[model samples]
Target: MPHRKVGSSIHLSGQLPFKDGELLGQGVVGRDVELETAQELARHAALNCLAAAVQAVGDLDRVRIVQMLVFVASTPDFGEQSQVANAASELLIEVLGENGRHARTAIGVAGLPLNTPVEIQVICTAV
Candidate 1:
C-alpha cells in the first residue's frame, strides 16, 4: 500500500515473494530454485503486482500490465532467467488474457532483496 501517486497512476515497488514475513525461494533461482518453484514465485510476484494495481485504482478490469522486469537471484552458472520469469508471464497471461501480454525484461542477478529466488517489478496503466 505504500505507493506513490502519479496523475491517474500509482507506482509500486518491486514485488517480493514473501508470505507472513517469510521469504519464498530462499536459494538461487537457477540452482536451488526448481522450475516449478521459480514459476510459482513468479506467479506470486505477478499476483502481488496486480493486487497493487487493483488497490491503487480500485478496479481490476481497468488495469493493464505495461511492462515487467524480473530479477532472478541465481548462481553465476544460472542461465534460465527467461524460464523463471515465465512463471509471472504465464500467470498474467492467464489472468488478464490478451491484455496480460507485455514487454518484459528478465535477467539473472547475484542476489535479491530478502534472498528471494525471483523478484518482479511491474509497471501498469489504468484503462
Candidate 2:
C-alpha cells in the first residue's frame, strides 16, 4: 500500500494476475504461445494493474491513462509482441474510454516471474 508521487505521476508496485487461491499460468513459451492466448494473459495482467490502481487511489473513473508497458516471454522465433499487447490496450480503452488511449511498449523478454506469458505496468493521471 505504499505510494510515491512525483510531478503528475504515481509509481505503483509491481502487480500480477491473481485471485483467491489462483493465479495466471506459467511455463508458456512464446513460439507456442497463441496470439489469442497471449492476449488473454495480457488482459489478465492489465486487470491486475486495475486492481492495484483501485486499491491505491480508490477509483478508475478519474484515471487518465498515460502509458502501459507489457512484457512477454518470447521464444526466439516469436514475433507477435504488439498483437499480444493489444488485449491489454483494448481492455483499458474499453473500461476507461478516451482516458485509456495511451502510449504502449510491448516487449519480448527472456522470461518473467512465475513464468507468466505476460506482465503489465500502467501509468496514469488520476483526479
Model-by-model lDDT, in order? Answer: 0.81, 0.78
Model 2 stretches astray by more than 4 angstroms: 1-3
lDDT of 2 by residue, 1-127 (tens): 6345568786655555565546666755556577787788788888777777766667988777788888888887888889988989999999989988989998888988887788788787787
Model 2 / residue 41 / CA error / Å: 1.0
Least accurate 10 contiguous residues by lDDT in model 1: 1-10
Q: After superposition, how far is residue 97 of candidate 2 from its true place, in Å?
A: 0.2
For model 1, the stretches where C-alpha displacement exceeds 4 angstroms are: 7-9
RMSD of each: 1.7, 1.8
Best lDDT among the predictions, by candidate number: 1
Per-model TM against the reference: 0.89, 0.89
Clashing pairs in 1: none
- Candidate 2 scores a C-alpha RMSD against the true structure in Å of 1.8
